[model samples]
Target chain A: MQIFHRSTNTISRATIFGAVFVVAALFWVAATVQRSPYVTYAGVARPQPAPFSHQHHVAGLGIDCRYCHTSVETSSFAGIPPTKTCMNCHSQIWTNAAMLEPVRESYRSGKSLVWNRVNDLPDFVYFNHSIHINKGVGCNTCHGPVDRMPLMYNYASLQMEWCLDCHRAPEKYLRPREQVFNMRYQEPSSSQPVLVDGQPYTDQLSLGMDLVKKYKLRTATDIMSCSTCHR
Target chain B: MRNCRKISLLGALMLLLAGCRQDMHDQPRFKPLAESDFYADLRSARTPVEGTVARGQLHEDTYFYTGKIGNNPGDFMPFPVTEEVLARGRERFDIFCAPCHSRLGDGNGFVPSRGFPRKPPSYHSERLRKAPLGYFFDVISNGFGIMPDYASQIPARDRWCIIAYVRALQLSQNATMADVPSGEKVPSELPRFEEPGSGATLPVVEPKSANSAPEEPK
Candidate 1:
């Protein structure tokens, strides 16, 4: 050990101290990168076969979500619209448009047009759309402002922590069952008090709390149990 | 440099571990409507084999399924209509039928407005207003002229529910105040719009309270 100069001790100590900071910074970078759009694809729009605009269909055309997503209220999978649903109006309205050629071809060939999945979840998560819909959870609560999305994108990080935030306290986001499909639904406010059973609520907490009781939502502890989503 | 060799070997091991990180997140089984390479069609969801029926899908009640008695459309609902039934009917109708047949059942819906070629007939018209409940149900199950069949999309029970709502709309357009029963209010409270709760704490707003709102500017 004496073969090295006394200055080596100082250098060694500085290196040791710097390693702690370097490790911390590396961990911080790792976490930052994990949650970033690059990893989670949260705000990024995935390419689809066609540039179908939810903004135009939902907001512009005033089409209800259930019109195309028929089994949303009954099944775990929000049934994707078959080629027939697109042809419902497109068959008459935009029959010759070049943009709709894929849809037209799918109809003629009797082959399904494979639309890209935008909000795919890991296979481990057993999320049920019908249960959430029945429990008075708004579609926008998780899907975000779908009426404003020109091209579909995942609005939230589909992470466990993101899901647990709602599972821990669902009352914070619960809306009336009727407002579940309404993308333009607003939270309770003094100016626009939400009426439930003819009893107007001026605050979201009071309204949500009431909805929790009325909807018979399971306790936070029960929903928070790992099995709730994992199974 | 033996140390250098050891470090390089460690790095190789780490790279091997990283490359093997494909388990758990996506398991072996397919998700709903996922693409499958195993099948020629590339569809994970397969249709039921021909002439085979799943459990509970026998469709025992012929009237409920077809909305017909012996070939002609029947004149009744499969079940008694309730406030809840009508509420569900209205919700379902607004989703499925209102595009071409407007929410008002006036054939002035957004789809028709956008040149849907054939405007759906108004439910309020004499020909449609007099149409039996089963007739409407038949039209929904089997496609009417220019309209596609909705049998696959809407369940049988919901078809009946929609027919009930359509009848309600028909009566609403031609109804007089006298049609309401005595002592019962005209423009009754829509029980569905009531705020969610146990519904035990407060009664619905009285008719007078609703009428007491400030009048619209002339």
Candidate 2:
């Protein structure tokens, strides 16, 4: 006995194939977009125990980055500010504020508030904060304009390609050694030559190249080697 | 049969999604300070063996490390205070000490204005100006009063450099005309000090809106 009509079978098969194709395309797009560095990492602000505003501390008060991130220049990790660091000001200024209750509780109990990590790299990547900072790479180069971020988010895609882009040609991102901490430091205008000790000079690119030599930065080949990061 | 085929197809899609979740996050590793049955102490973290000097941490020079010579704060710097060293000291001081001690060493930093525990003693004050080089080093290495020790944050050499910068700051505040080199040109006019409440001198700051205003005094 014939179980199916011949004409309907072809139409049903085609419809099924079409449906499968549409579902597969939708799935691919969703997976790719979700996992892309731009969507997955950059600008994604994770929740912290307190609504700490970098803008208020850095811009409003003009507190330096080194004030709270005390170890950025010396250690591998740019440490989160300790409870004592918070109480150093909050205990006197916002002593009774409900917003700073967690800070007060942490101070009293001697427990650290578990701040959610925003710029997370895979465990395999070996990133050193001190090396980058010491080599005249501005904090804003990686962290973006943290002084303006009311709620800090991951500014750059902390992906391999993203890191290699800077590692390849660091001169474009390099600033003067003194300007490393100046979050709002702007590049000198190319049209107008800045007067340096009575001599006019208009070569930021050359200056950056000189700095690369002065700082003894590794060549792109050495930096891009597999073991440089993977180990 | 048709219903079974549909369910199987759904199951295949679910399996594909499940395959994506490779357990890289939950790896088989001991977290720091985690309890361990494998070790007698049951601590995953092993204590360093007796007298184990870490690499690059052999701080053998007693004078350099402690800033003391035979139980007394030494008067001289461990390293020569070169121009480069002073520059490094200036950078480190601005980053570390200037928060509490101010850039001018006046102890009226932004933190103090915002009500930190107490204003640190001014480095320019006669008492501090006369303080031996090692005294500042000692204070930085092992904190004075409410201030935390910067030993971990600053290297021993950098601490000495900071001391050098502090001395320079003191001299800057108290320098006489004789202190200036005869060959170098000094500014013809001293900077005019602006009196407080002088409208012309002070930049205009917008008043805080009612919503952002500080709470009324109790």
lDDT of each: 0.84, 0.74
- The lowest-lDDT stretch of 10 consecutive residues in candidate 1 chain B is B197-206
Kept native contacts, as fractions per model, are 0.30, 0.16
Please identify model 1 stretches exceeding 4 Å from their true place. Answer: A1-15, B2-20, B180-218
- Individual DockQ of the candidates? 0.27, 0.14
Residue-level lDDT of model 2, residues B33-132, one tens digit each, is: 3446798645565767888987887888989998898888998988888987988887778777876677788988766676665788888777888888
Estimate, for each residue in B55-148, the C-alpha lDDT of model 1 and write its tens digit: 9999889999998999999999899999878988988888889877877999988777876767888989999988889998989988988888
Top-scoring candidate (DockQ) = 1
lDDT of 1: 0.84
How many clashing residue pairs are found in candidate 2? 0
Score residue A76 of candidate 2 by CA lDDT. Answer: 79
Q: In candidate 2, what are the lDDT values of residues A1-231, reduced to their tens digit? A: 988788988999899989999999999998788657556568877788899998877766666787678778887788777677786567567788888999999889765576777886666677889888888898988999887789879898777777988888887777656667777655645553322222333576765676788789888789888998878
Instruction: Name every residue pair that clashes in candidate 1.
Output: A196-B195, A196-B196, A197-B194, A197-B195, A197-B196, A198-B195
Candidate 1, what DockQ? 0.27
